[model samples]
Target: MRRFKGFVRGVDGLTRDRGGNFAVLFGAVASVLALGVGFAVNISQLYNARSSLQSVVDAAVTSTARDLTLGVIKEADAKASVQAFLDANSAAGILQANQIVLDKLTINRTAKTVQADVHADIGLYFPLFSVGDMQRVTTSTTALYSDKKIEVAMMLDITGSMAPNWRSKTDKIGDLKAAASQTVEDLLKQNRDPGDPRIRVAIVPYAEAVNTGGLADTVFVEAEGGPKVPPPIDTPLSVSVTTATDKCATERKDKDGYADYSSDGPYTLRQDNKGKTYQAKVNRDYRMKVCPTAALVPLTADMSRLLTAIDHFQAAGVTAGGIAVQWGYYMLSPSWRSAIADACLGAGPTNFDQKKVAKIAILMTDGQFNTAFARSRGASRSQDQGQVSRSNAEAICENMKRDGIEVFTIGFDLNDPSMTTTERDQAKSVLKDCSTDDSSSLKHYYEAANGAELSDAFGAITRNIENLTINR
Candidate 1:
């Protein structure tokens, strides 16, 4: 400031000089410099205002495009959505939006092209070449809000907590059934071509464990492509039902503990056991009481199968969210297609990371995850069953994300006011860590206080997954 004052004083002295011709030249030079500086400052404000406004428009258009694709809004409401978004974001930039005209908002239902044109009269800080204090800035954006092929794995929690009435209004399980069924209908409807459904959904209803049911055939050579559950075990039988050393085939911990924790089966599933004991053959120390009773469905595009799986889901047993997530990845992974060919309907993909294919996992849990076991006795396996389960859930989610699977997590009514702080913190931590990333505080992780919130969360997950498209 002192330097600037000194500069001003020098210029004033020059203007006051007795020599008339020299004083005139210096005054003219000072005038030009001041005008240039003022122009630069004003121009910078204009640039900044335009840039901020452009961001607001871009975000508004993207949200509108997504809503349209999700069928929540039509072409008519899209323009309205634009106006609402602008109004909502009025304070976001330097200029206040006085008027907005949706000059061209086109949604080609047949061609699936969404183009939007927005013209806004924004109050400018400094006038540009256009002679007004307000600038009419027009911005446009285009996006193809449709997916080529989407494979989603939904892991629904059927643990004991989900069996009861929800808060007061709903039967929790009924709400889950309704939410999941509607999500299926919504996703399938995204295919503009009715005959060409590029969407496939898998359901993993988890309780004490995920009941792979028929898909276990892909895991055990002994079941000979058959079911692995009881004729009811009267006592711990000495005989091995499946060729699995541990008598557990469809469940990953077949020959070795390592294979149990992994989605990829590496052990000799059919080989005869040389060990004398079941534990020795299976290479596992303990046995889970029984897998969940609710049926498990692999990835399938058939809407009927998807809905049926949701209907068959009954609330029972404990929570093994980690196990359910591990199986969810298997449903989406291309490598498992060969083994799960029958369940996957003989269809297969080239690779998991294919550009056009989107692999996603939607995990919803009603209570704290309490039944997870390490594939091997590693650092993750804890004496505290709840801790181990939560740990395993996060670890499996990490692996799935690393393999390019987008993960969305939901904790439905997990916060019981009576619970201890540690118990409350555990569920939130697991859900947050299980999501794709934390860039969006509201996107990947959801906390639903009741059934309505739960349904809303599911709706959001469905739309976000549906929006993953290469067509754009």
Candidate 2:
């Protein structure tokens, strides 16, 4: 009985010990605090993995969609393409190279979409109640690609400067040919049907003038005498009069106060007060200047023909860049469709349809525009040939933009040490004003210094032209 009472008293003493009770409480609290901190760390790890996986998937799907749009890869290869891209960039943020897996990929040709589902296995630092030791983070992405028909008119410069410099080994013309040809291949599919094509490109190589080739007689009036007026509006030209003798066409004569830059034409003989017949005359002095050896090719999907024209490009003549821009505008203008059709260009420019068709012009030049025959319609700095040409080009570019044609301009080697400050600024200004001012995804102006940069610029422009849109 005395021993039992002693044991009971010891238990009571232990329960009343404040120091030991406090120690027990601290141990319990420490265990819970450690678990909470570990849980938070696991959550943060999962979030990082999830974000990394999502970004990789988004990029993969977008790249796949672009390839599909560009015909770089077939739809059947899309799964492999996405997986490859994901694998290439798996270590984006706290992600192991092989941790992420491509679970599913869908290429819906009818919907023009590329969809991808990807997941990454993240090892947790601490596993808590109801939470597993490993967390699986899944992400999906979709990209919508446009299959809109594209009409591109490239105005290439073949001025004297583009020729190989005797002092240096720079070959601007050669670089241009290579880059431009590659751009055509990237933008268009091979072996397209002649009758029905989704894309067509026109090459306009200009120097002193745009060599209209077969389009000369159709668009330009014969320079038999001076501008004479008319035999009624619909009267045909007298067969006795010779057809346009020169293939190189200059700016249209500003006769009867007509808009010189306007492509809308009944390019036939016009009527004066009396019913006599005469057509607008081509500028004699301008046409007599050294014309480029390469001619303007109307829009066509014939890859062979397009590439062949690019190959035969020869640099010569003064820089008549404004005239080139004018012709570039005409190539994409539906108003000039009949003439282009007469020249056997495939299904000429389609009517302006914002949703279905993309009309584009890429104007490139290496030097200042120093040739103009038409009087300036805008405010010209000095009414000299350079200022007049700049004004004319700007006016035409504004008209093109107003008509829904997207303009992209490249000033190739404009900053060369040989060019004067005024010349460089003028060249850049013309191109800047001509290009579409987009504050969105891609810029419309590209200043390429060399061959590789030119190729890169063209590649970027083609991607933007494909118009890929992404959704997550």
TM per candidate = 0.63, 0.79
Best by TM-score: 2
Off by over 4 Å in 1: 1-140, 144-147, 165-170, 219-251, 254-261, 265-286, 343-350, 373-377, 380-382, 440-442, 470-472
Task: Report backbone clashes per prediction.
Answer: 3, 2
Backbone clash tally (model 2): 2
Q: Please, what are the lDDT tens digits per residue for candidate 2 over residues 1-472? A: 9999999999988878777878989999999999989988998998888888888888888888877655567778888998888879989999998888988887776777888877888888898888778888888898886556789999999988899876877999999999999999986663244566778899999988888876765444434454422223445557333444467876765545233676654354544545554454333332355867788888888888999999999988888777888889888888777777776665678888766678889999998999876665444445788887888888889988888888899889888999999999999999999898976676899999999999998888877776622211
* Best candidate according to lDDT: 2
Candidate 1 colliding pairs? 246-282, 252-260, 253-260
RMSD each, Å: 10.5, 6.3
